[model samples]
Target: MKRYPTVLTIAGSDSGGGAGIQADLKTFAALGAYGTAAITALTAQNTQGVRAIHAVPAAFLREQLEAVFEDITIDAVKIGMINTVDVVEVIAGVLDRFQPPFVVFDPVMVATSGAKLILDETVGVLKTQLFPRATLITPNLDEARMLLKKPIESVDQMREAAEELIAQGCRAVLLKGGHLVAARLYDVLAVRGEATQVFESEYIASKNVHGTGCTLSSAIATYLALGHALTEAVSLAKAYVSGAIQAGKDITTGQGSGPLNHSYAPKPMQIRS
Candidate 1:
């Protein structure tokens, strides 16, 4: 029997269908990887904002992980929207045991609409325990500031923040500059012992940007599962997201911020040779 790259996303469920596990699954399918998920929370959310969050029991979350690991060879894993320290601990435990080849962590601390998605105290554990295990951790300006306890308002600051995050023990950091007001968007990738690589794209103007961070991180995982180098995976993922945003830029979905066009141009499944 033929096999293919498989990716797992550990995140919350978004009823909006634009972000969280929904976006991760769409991104994985679009990028030619089999997708699996272990949802950590069930969020009452939509395009506008998150109303409430119901976190799954950490034991139940662990069970979900065991089920996937027992039968699937997860080539890569992308983590998002882990709302509590318990969930963080659960993820760290399973990952340490299985040790996937690539892990992309999008620290989903805040929502696109400025709602807080996690407890403030959980940030400390995430940095010390979770970030260090990731192949790359993608954080936008607000999330970066929250993690660093300061402001990051420019590309230069983003570069500095990326390095600082690396100092916290992560293998690499991808500081997203999407919130910086600029003609171009620059995402800084700082890997240990390697020169920083800046990935750029023309910033598309649109409200359909919800789930973009999740999408990018998941795409990175998918490409990594497909055997792309870390930098190449990041580059391809950014391009994929930019195209997805442009494809649905003018279209309207919900009354608030809508989702990216993840399936705008899908790729065929990749079969392992």
Candidate 2:
């Protein structure tokens, strides 16, 4: 029997089902990979905003990671929303020990409602421990600005910020430009000592961009698990996300910012034969 490529999400649980582990699993299934998760925290949140967050203990988080690594074959990983410095350190230790083939990190700091998800101290831990281990780090404009400790208001500035992040030990950086003022959306992918790749698409005016960054990173992990090159995985993920945004434009899920149609380019799961 041929086994399906498996992708894992080591992140928080979103009760809203629009982001975090839920979104990552949906994206993996839609992209033809089997999905697994090791939740680091539980968040009581909806489309409007996050109301409460209860973080799991670091030891419990480690147990979850060990359980998956001991049994399942995880081909790739997508990490999001580690709320504390301890949790971040625990995850970093696990990843360093196991070393998954492809790891995509979505540095989720602020929620759609403008509430901070990760504590300030945790950001430093993330930069020092986790960023260097990621195959790709996806940060939106605001998140990038915070990480670089500077303002990024233009394409030129975005390029420079990406360079700075690469210097900070990230293998590659995908600086999302959705927050910039432009008719077209631009995301810059920069790898160390390589030319930057710009991915551009027509800006689709829609309110259904809730979990876009999470979905994109998950999609890229799925494609990477399926043997696609890094550049190809990112390119395909961008197209998939754009289609999902367009598909869910008018459809309203909640009162606030809604989620993207993760199944926009759905593929059948690769069943074992």
Which candidate leads in TM-score?
Answer: 1
Q: Candidate 2 — what's its lDDT?
A: 0.91
Query: Alpha-carbon error at 199 in model 1, in Å?
Result: 1.7
Q: Which lDDT tens digits does candidate 2 get at residues 176-196?
A: 999999988889999998999
lDDT of 1 by residue, 102-163 (tens): 89999999999898899978999999889889989999999989888988887888899999
Q: What C-alpha RMSD separates each model from the true structure?
A: 0.8, 1.2
TM-score of each: 0.98, 0.97
Any idea how many clashes model 2 has?
Answer: 0
lDDT accuracy of residue 245 in candidate 1:
99
Residue 18 shift from truth in candidate 1, angstroms: 0.3
Q: Candidate 1 — worst ten consecutive residues by lDDT sum?
A: 148-157
Q: Mark the 10 consecutive residues where model 2 has the least summed lDDT.
A: 264-273
